[model samples]
Target chain A: EAGVVQSPRYKIIEKKQPVAFWCNPISGHNTLYWYLQNLGQGPELLIRYENEEAVDDSQLPKDRFSAERLKGVDSTLKIQPAELGDSAVYLCASSRTGIKEQFFGPGTRLTVL
Target chain B: AQSVTQLDSHVSVSEGTPVLLRCNYSSSYSPSLFWYVQHPNKGLQLLLKYTSAATLVKGINGFEAEFKKSETSFHLTKPSAHMSDAAEYFCVVSPSSGNTGKLIFGQGTTLQVKP
Candidate 1:
């Protein structure tokens, strides 16, 4: 089975610009998550989705970031007026319902200059 | 709140020597724990996990970890290290309060294998 997939493996944008990343979860999976990994740090959760509903998004920076999982299959995360500190690796993961194990995708490396 | 701590920021060992990466956690109740590996420019990969099952869990690439509830520790180890084992490893914890699978991750440890 194919693992979670993310698009724009790498992105570079200037500060105050807008950027967006896409993700496609594994087939038959019901849970999806987005994480941010700064250099030298572990991945931190940004948002989580069960089907098309966002169940947990307490960590997301709502003022400049927004995410949506349309059709319960694919997802998109957008950041407007991106700041320098927003540069990090954005990871996507998926899991079956009630399961604790998650499969991850090659992240999008975002560079905000 | 649940949290995880990786004791070391970096660990270096010979290619044929044993490997150990320490981790500790804090949770209100029993928790599900995991160890994941990330090579340079690569995505995170599951190494092993502990969810109130056996204390000792074996994972890919000859890696293993023992969950010690008494000590609140889960340390990853390998009998013999390989050059490919050089990478960053993260310790994670999922709260038992819910099955949402949301995780808290540690700062991570970088492993270096010398030839």
Candidate 2:
């Protein structure tokens, strides 16, 4: 079984620039999640998706961060006019259903210069 | 709301030594607890999980966690440490609803092992 898959293992962007990250969850998984991991810290949940519906996204910075899980199989997280503090590893994970064990993908390490 | 706390920021152990990582959680309802490991540049991997099913849960990589309802703790342990076990470990909790299925992670504990 293929685990979750993410693109752009690493990314470098200038401050105030817009950046996007993509994720393709495991087959038949109905729950998808996006998390941000700062250096030396554990991951923090940014958003969660049940199929195409975003059920929880309170932690996401609404002013600059946006995410979509269209088609219910893949997801995209976008950050507009990014800041230096936005630099962190963007991790994506998926599970069979709510609260079940999740499989993660190689995260995208974003470096905002 | 659900939250977790990793007791140690870092732990060092020699090979063959017992491994222990402490974790405490808070949740109003019965929450699911989990332990995950992350090697540098890699994503989080499930080491073990403790649902309401059993207090003693074993997971991959020769790891195990005991859920103590009285203490509200789920600490990961191994009989012996290996150099490969050096990584960042996180304790996580998920609410039965709301953040349902969404994990709230601790600050993380770095495990260092020496041969």
Candidate 3:
């Protein structure tokens, strides 16, 4: 089975510009998650979606970040007026319902300069 | 709330030697623990997981981990090191309560294998 898939493996944008990343979870999976990984650190959760409902998004920077998993299949994460600190790798993952083990995508490396 | 700590930032092992990466976790209740490996420029891959089952869990690529409740530790180990085993390893924990599936990850341990 194909693992999670993400688009624009690498992105470069100027500070204050808006940037977006896309993710497509594995087939038959009902739980999806977004994570951010800074250099030399482990990934930090951003948001989680159970089907189309965002069950947990406490870590998301609401002022500048927004995410949606419409139709319960694909998802998108957007950042407006990106700042230099926003430069990091964005990872997407998915798993079967009630399963904690996740399959991750290659990730989108965003560079805000 | 749950958290994980990788005791070592980096470890070096000679090819054919044993490998060990230490991890400790804090949780209010029984937790699901996992080991994930990430090769440079690649995404995280599951090495193995312990979910209140066997304390000794064997994973892919000849890696394994032992979950010790008394010590609150889950340390990854490999019988013998291989050059290809050089990568960053992360320890993770998730609540075993309602099965939310939200994970807390450790900083990470970088393994270096010498020829």
Candidate 4:
């Protein structure tokens, strides 16, 4: 079976510009997660969706970051007026409900100048 | 509270030699541990997992890890390291109680394989 799919493996944008990343989870997976990985560090969870409901978003920066998983299949993470500090890899992962193992995507590397 | 710490930021080993990467974890309850490997620009792949079943968990690519509750450690080891084993390895933990399946990852260890 194919793994999780993410679009635009790489993106570059100037500071203060809006950016968006998309993700499609593995088939039959009911849990989706968005994580931010900074250089020389492990990935930190930004948001998590159980089907179409976002159950965990405490780590997400609501002032500039927003995410949605409509139809419970695909997800989109958006950053409005992104800053240079926002430059990092945005990773998407999926897992079966109640499963502890998560499958990760290749991730989108965003470079903000 | 749950957290993980990788003992090494980088480890160098010659090809065909043994490889070891250390990891330590802290959790309020019995935790599910995992080892994940990530190649350059590639997604994270599951190398092995310990879910309270067997203390010795074997994974792909000749990798294996032993979970030691007494030491709060789950260290990855390989009898013979190959060039392809060079990558970033992360140690992760998920608390068993109130388990939302949230994974806590370590800083990661970069393995360098020498010829």
Candidate 5:
């Protein structure tokens, strides 16, 4: 089975520019997640999607970051007016259900210059 | 609130030597635990998991982690280290509270293997 798929494996943007990351999860998966990982650190959950509904997104930065899982199969995470501190790896993961194991994508490495 | 802690930020060992990565967790009631490995420039892979099923859980690539409830610890260990074992290891926790789905990750521990 194919693992989670993400586009634009690497991205470079200016401090005030807008950046978006895309994710396509495995088939029949009902749960999708977005996570941020800084250098030398583990991934921290940013948002979670159960079908087309966002059940948990308290960790997401409401001020500058926004995410959506349209149709419940794919997702997009966007950061507007990016900051240098936003430089990190953004990982997308999915699972068959809320209780199953998650499979992660290769992650998009965002470098805010 | 639940959290996980990886005791070591970095661990160095010689090839063919034993490898150990310490992890401890704090959770209310029963919890599900996991160990994942991430190679450089790669994504995370499930190593093993403890869901109150087995105290001693074996995982892919000859990796294993023991869940100690009394000590609230789950440490990853391997009999012998290989060069390929050099990577980042993360201890993960999932609360058993209802159907609320989330995985809390500990600060990753980098593993370095020397010949």
Candidate 6:
């Protein structure tokens, strides 16, 4: 089975510009998650989706960050007018419901200048 | 609240020598723990997990971890280190009582294997 897939392995943009990252979870996986990883730190959960419903998004920055999982298979995370502090690796992961193990994608490394 | 802490930010080991990565966890209830390895420009890979099973859990690529409840520790160990073992490793914890399967990760430990 193919693992989780993410587009644009790396991205560079100036501050105050809008950026978006895409992710396709593994087949038959019902749980999808988005995480942010700063340099030298482990990934932190930003949002979680369960088949089109965002069940957990307490960590997401609602002011500028937005995410959507339309069909429950693919997800898009968007950052509007991003700040320099927004520069980090955005990771997408998926797993079966109630399963503890999560499969991660290659991640989109965003560099904001 | 559940959290994990890696004792070392970086560890260097010579090839063919033993490898040890220490991790400590804090949780209110029984916790599910995991070790994941991430190569440069690569996604994280699961190394091993402990879920109230046997104290010693073996995983892929000749790695293992012992879960000590008394110590609140789950340390990864390798009998022999290989050049390919150089990577960043994370210790993670999951709340046993939650159905969301959310994971809390440590800062991470970078392993440097010297040949």
Best-matching candidate per lDDT: 6
| Tens digit of per-residue lDDT, candidate 3, span B8-87 | 99999999999999999999999999999999889899999999989999999999999999999999999999999999
The reply for model 2, stretches above 4 Å from the true place, is B97-99
Measured with C-alpha atoms, the lDDT of residue A112 in candidate 3 is 95
- Pull out the clashing pairs in model 4: none
Order by lDDT, highest first: 6, 4, 3, 1, 5, 2
Instruction: Quote the lDDT for B76 in model 1.
Output: 97
Candidate 3: the clashing residue pairs are: none
Candidate 6 has which clashing residue pairs, if any?
none
Error of 5 at B56 (Å): 0.2
B1-115 in candidate 1: lDDT tens per residue? 8999999999999999999999999999999999999999888999999989899999998999999999999999999999999999999999877787888899999999999
Clashes of 3: 0
Residues A5-42 of candidate 6: C-alpha lDDT, one tens digit per residue:
99899999999999999999999999999999999999
Cα TM-score of candidate 1: 0.98
* Candidate 4 residue B90 C-alpha distance from true site, Å: 0.1
Q: Which sections of candidate 6 miss by over 4 Å?
A: none
Among incorrect, acceptable, medium and high, the docking class of model 3 is high
- lDDT against the true structure, each candidate: 0.95, 0.91, 0.96, 0.96, 0.94, 0.97
Off by over 4 Å in 4: none
Pick out the ten consecutive residues of candidate 4 chain B with the lowest summed lDDT.
B95-104
Model 5: per-residue Cα lDDT over A1-113, one tens digit each: 88899989999988999999999999998999999999989999999999999999999999999999889999999999899999999999998775757899999999999
Model 6 agreement with the true structure over B19-106: per-residue lDDT tens digits: 9999999999999999999999999999999999999999999999999999999999999999999999999999999687799999
Give the C-alpha interface root-mean-square deviation per candidate. 0.7, 1.7, 0.6, 0.7, 1.1, 0.5
Per-residue lDDT value at B13 in model 2:
96
